[model samples]
Target: MPEFKTEPYITDSHHHLSHQDFSSDIEEVIGRAREAGVEILIEGGGEVALPYYLKNCLSDPYLRNMYFCAGLHPHDAMNFSDSILDKLRSLATHKRFAGVGECGLDYHYDNSPRDVQKRVFRKHIELASELKKPLAIHARKSYRDVFGILEDEGVPEAGVLFHCFSGGDEDLARILEMDGYISIGGVLTFPNAVRTREVISSVPRERLLIETDAPYLAPQNVRGKRNEPSYIRYVADELANLWGLPVEDVYFITTYNARVFFNIDIDHGGDIVYKLGDRLYLNVTNRCTNRCSFCIRNFRDGLGGYYLKLRVEPTPDEVIKAIGIPGEYEEIVFCGYGEPLIRYDLVREVARYIKERGGRVRVNTNGIARLYHGVDAIEYVSNYVDVFSISLNATNGEEYNRICRPLYKGAYKEVLKSIERAKSLNKEVRVSFVESSGADLTGAEDMAEALGVSVR
Candidate 1:
């Protein structure tokens, strides 16, 4: 029932509007994609007319939402030469150029000799490395050889994306090992794509992106039909189902990933306040006490479509002004890309203001404020903070230290002490444990129970 409230924030990361299939109706296709909420369409697949078609798209109002990549396809590897590389270098300087290639080996068709394919693929790799751009690779039944060539060539410093990836878990592991991203397409919706469904879930959300690979692989609903960017919602739907999230959530996550992949800047000017569902979260600062192994900031700049990497830490007045009508949200939370308590005075001021405005307040913290402030920091903010959600990622100090990597010694003990102080004040409190951190969830729950607080 939860549908996208606006044009769905889908980014068709790999498409081929230059393909002859859309030559007659390209304008209509672009319009339909815009209507469907496809915010971006990264046109790729380096065919002969790709450069000229992309140039036209850049100037076309209907295709303004598109970005492009240029290179030689494996099928035309025989045509690869210095002149083509020179052409690619010139194209790479374009303002709208997002990446280098949709180039790699495709043994499935064998349109070009395997030796030539490998040779040209290496050239593209070297070119992408020299240009410092991400490479959009296409490998079909040649992932083993493709990965081998990449390992030998040294992946581009800008990054690499295995687009329309159909590899198994081992191939995925290799991609991840190389710190590469993989973009899934319509194949995910095929009833027979059990391997993909089972394997893709293991991909870290931050490292994952979605694409339509239009004019090629169409989702089950549009099977055997000419695919276009508008149908990307089907791929999003499948990702949503696999990730057990709302379709809109998949749209935001994948859209954010695509933007980060292509280095698209979203200038919202350092969001002091952001919304997720009905809760308004205050991004008071980008400073955290612990470098948690499972922290989202380690992977991406933003979360839930809001860029939390602040240009400057917001003043208390800035945060309060941003939360114009605090009571409109279910609750105003002091949880952002960083530790709220690190800015304890700011948290206290903003929380007090929200509480007076009939707005409920929650403060999520690593619970090490007492050590930093040399006082009962939890109790200091307890009057205004209605609920305290603290991180209890591990049961004991040793385990906590290993996972959180806090800057201070005895920091884990301080976290436990802070929780005790909150409970003593009779504040509503919950301690959280991250399952993916490989910590003992049962131990954390038992520790929280002994402290008379609920486990989140």
Candidate 2:
């Protein structure tokens, strides 16, 4: 088999570190995982033996990044006792204990009576809610029952994860409806797993996560061998192929999802300014009026490697500091996960700073600024912004309404007026259209022509 290249970063969202299979070579296994870019590992501690495993393995600084979830597995539901439940509840408060479970029902094995499994699962759900922590679930052939149980018990506000999800469209719809996350594993690479692949394709990118259920479900390429955290790169590769995104994107996104889901502390410092080639892009805010079908924020936080989901919007001074010596780049552009025009004053202030420092300024907007601000925004922006690249996503008003879903009722007409106004002000205006499936590109181009602007 060809060697699988490691991504820049990856998080094995689910794995079994305490499984007796790796006791002898656990150190080497962890080494291999780190070398392969598995930066974080969430060990599955559903079985009673997990506390012992963690006691033995967690002292090593090298394994410090590992976190574990404690709960009863359906397979162990038959052996469920108050003593075991007490042990799990104690472990739930451990500093490294990230969540509750690997705890749902598994009807395929029938290792435990169906009624027993349901009762044990309810306890786990209640524990998660009481402790305010995420629930990592293990479900197989019991998706419907699991959903019903979760509904009955009321899902924990902290969140729920369907670990190593192997479900169909109906299950996926239900999971999404509950705002639950689906962590996929090596099964994604199986040739016959068509239904799982469809679930993968349909899942919103932000809700998607990757895992390696190590020592279990090794990927198709290494089917018979013992799985390990190092093999998470293979799962990420398959996800990239399924999503038609770059492997690096899959790595970063899954890692971000894991960090957020587990509430793991990592430095996200809010990259306000990012550079691509000669252009510098400033991310001032995440607020936007339109929920466009093709917007990247639906899939991930930011473009390239920068995480643009700002916890707090930056001030003009902060933005200017982020753009220090702006003349270094060919042009400084105001564009980010949000519509830049929403923070009109901030844009003007920062644009003035860049322009004073001999930097060219451009603004990428969704063209509803006028409607958003209830004024002639183009006139104000033209004074400071040298160029305007507006999104004319659809050709006609009806098409615009369907694709952009702007908050304003007559947003499409406002966009057309904004374009004409920008041209009248003699500002360098360029209209861009994203080629979504079924978008009327010809009509969009004709609209741009009518407005006397170039289409990009």
Candidate 3:
């Protein structure tokens, strides 16, 4: 195998490395994975042979980089029993056990009764909840039932992952809405997987994972061959193309996501500058002017994959230093858990630095700067900002006040004024609304149209 020195080290987020097919040369496969720059392997195990593999396999130094998750596969749901659950609970006690699945509904195969699959999948959900481990789910032609069961069972607090995801656009939306992560495999590289490619491209890299599903579903380039962790690069390459990113960016983003999802050790200490796709986002503050009901930080401290809850906000100089070279990214975005305009000075400083260095600058704001800091605030920032992404969030002040709950009265009017002001300056301005918030999307669009700006 050729070495991948230039590519970033990646993780095979889900794989059956312990399957019987690799019994003859498992060690050599690991060696090849290492050679391919695969730094981590998440092994999905739930078969009867797992005990034997655990007893004898983990002693290898290579296995140290491997984490394991165990549960009954949907095909084997018929064999599930309380005793098997007991065995799984025992396995969960293992120091290396990371999650509780590779289990869900697979109606396409029907190897197990549909009812039995649902029941066993619920058990795995409960077990994962009890064990405080994330879930690695398997759903094939069963996304509806799988999502229904998850909603009914109450998704595990630890987290949930859809392994080898092959869902449609609606399914993908539902998964992301629930903050679930999806892992893609070699199927992405298939010429006929047009739907898969389209849906996967819409997924934020922060919510994506790459896997090879070894001994099965090898990529198009190696269609007849047995898949292994080393082939994860093919999946990464496909995802990179779909997301319009460098393959190394996909590797870094997905690997970071996998580590965070599986609760693996990785330094995610409130990143000041974080990369998502080709844009670099600066998390300048955790403070915001409005307490929007749809804000994600209220439920979780992270977005996409990076931790955004800052204990201490970075100085403008510190942020500039963290950014390294501004021109390296497609755009430097002033967006994070908080509204960037809350620190209008920091935005001016950092955006100026980015713009001066031949980089494009975009500010994601709540449009409250004009309300608090006066008209000049927007005018000054407009000088350096290439684009303004303001959150309209609602159709009118009544709805805005109810949904956003801004600290000041007439904040919605100020937001509208800010949008009009930005447009007057010929700034590339777009307004965004949260669909899940019961916000009036059509009204927001009309408002944006009246203001002569685009809606995002």
Candidate 4:
């Protein structure tokens, strides 16, 4: 909103950049990361990146500021021969390399012999200590054994990081006591990810970092699809809500922690968002027609500094550009702190985007589009809008004028006119009431009856 060139980057301290999920074109992976503001992406622990460290693995990977952590996955414990350990240990010496082992016991899948897993995991712990660097760990249903080992073995001087942590507050507090930074993943975005949210809510901002764990544990929208570094916005948003801070603030704290903890540099914190959720809720402008009492947007700014700031109300093309590709959401909600109809053309353009993609569009308005954006607004709705939930604050101009307190002259009549048009153009229209005593319910019902539009 202020026209500041916000840094659009982040550091993913934990991911398998070398897994087959990225084999097709790793360069594109890096490029996409850059586009999404990811400047430095640290591999959780990948043998795939080892070749890049082979002096000729890939051009200047280490010097490029990209990094890798090497270790045997506990699931692959059976493959942990003396030679493999030697190979991983060898890569640990690379300047671009940081930390060790995403390797830990997986009680869920004891694919590797328990004894073998334990032995290999300890070897990685020892490697972290010997190398004097951190150890990136993977603990799944085996926190007891994992934490016991780290506590016994003495966490490496570079310290420890619990990668893609899906643990409880107790585990988090224990890990924090051990001086380990908790890096969270897509699990935090799941509506039912209660545990992840609990961990997020309890942890201090300074102790967290966000990760895609790409090619795996993909965040909600991209579930089953190949996850990438750019989708971190969803994760960041969820964390921001959990901590009651802004997405930018979450990114800043996590990125700062990541940069400091991992000791990698390259501007990891700028416009940090976890994953781009389905509805890219854009507050096209903060200028609302109705002064709703419950509006978080009105009281706060841009949903936790998400840059959802609609300071320079964008044109429809700009809205479409901000919406880019139209596939990001189940529907792009035009609801913001203010009325979207304030920029009618912009709403039309965005609706067109969704219609083209066979996507849906929802416009949360005070039933005054015809008045604000003119007759053209309802015309656009006939074919473009799949669903519209309008605010029917009152039945007549007097009550409507009093409740909504619209600034536009004759605003009450304008809303009634818009509702009439909305009913004609959209098949699915529901006029909502705010469930307040001040509203005229009987009059609202009468109006809904007359307009053939149900009032809620």
Clashes of 4: 19
Model 2, 1-456: lDDT tens per residue? 111121246789899988989989988998999899887889877786575567776766655678988888899898888897788888877788899888989999999999999999998999899999999999999998999999899989989999999888899899989989999999999999988888788998778889989899999988999999999888888988987876877887777788778887434556687665467889888889898877887865655445677777888888887787878879999999899999888898889888888899999988897777776666776787889998888888888888888988888888878888888888899999988635777766677778889989
Global fold similarity of model 3 (TM-score): 0.70
Cα lDDT of model 4 by residue, 311-407, tens digit: 3565565555555555655666777656777667667777877789877777777766555545556556557776677787766777766766676
TM-scores of all predicted structures:
0.84, 0.72, 0.70, 0.56
Compose the digit string of candidate 1's lDDT tens values, residues 1-456: 111122236789999888888888887888899888897889885763474466567785745557888888899999988888888888888778888888999999999999999999999999889988899999999999998999899999989999988899999999999989999999999999998889999898888998888899999999999999999999988898898887877887888788887776555455566666567888877888799988988877787555678878888887777788877879989999898998888888999999999999999999986666676778778899899999989988888899899988989888888888888888999999999997766666677889899998
Off by over 4 Å in 1: 1-8, 24-28, 48-53, 59-65, 266-280, 304-306, 315-332, 344-360, 370-384, 396-414, 435-442
Runs off by more than 4 Å, candidate 4? 1-8, 46-49, 52-63, 266-456
* Whole-model lDDT per candidate: 0.84, 0.83, 0.84, 0.70
> Clashing residue pairs, candidate 3?
none
lDDT of 2 at 214: 84
- Worst window of 10 by summed lDDT in candidate 3: 1-10
Rank list by lDDT: 1, 3, 2, 4
RMSD in angstroms, all models? 4.3, 6.9, 6.3, 12.4
Comparing 1 with 4 on lDDT, the higher-scoring candidate is 1
**Which predicted model would earn the best TM-score?**
1
- Model 2, position 402, has a per-residue lDDT of 86
Q: For candidate 1, what's the RMSD?
A: 4.3
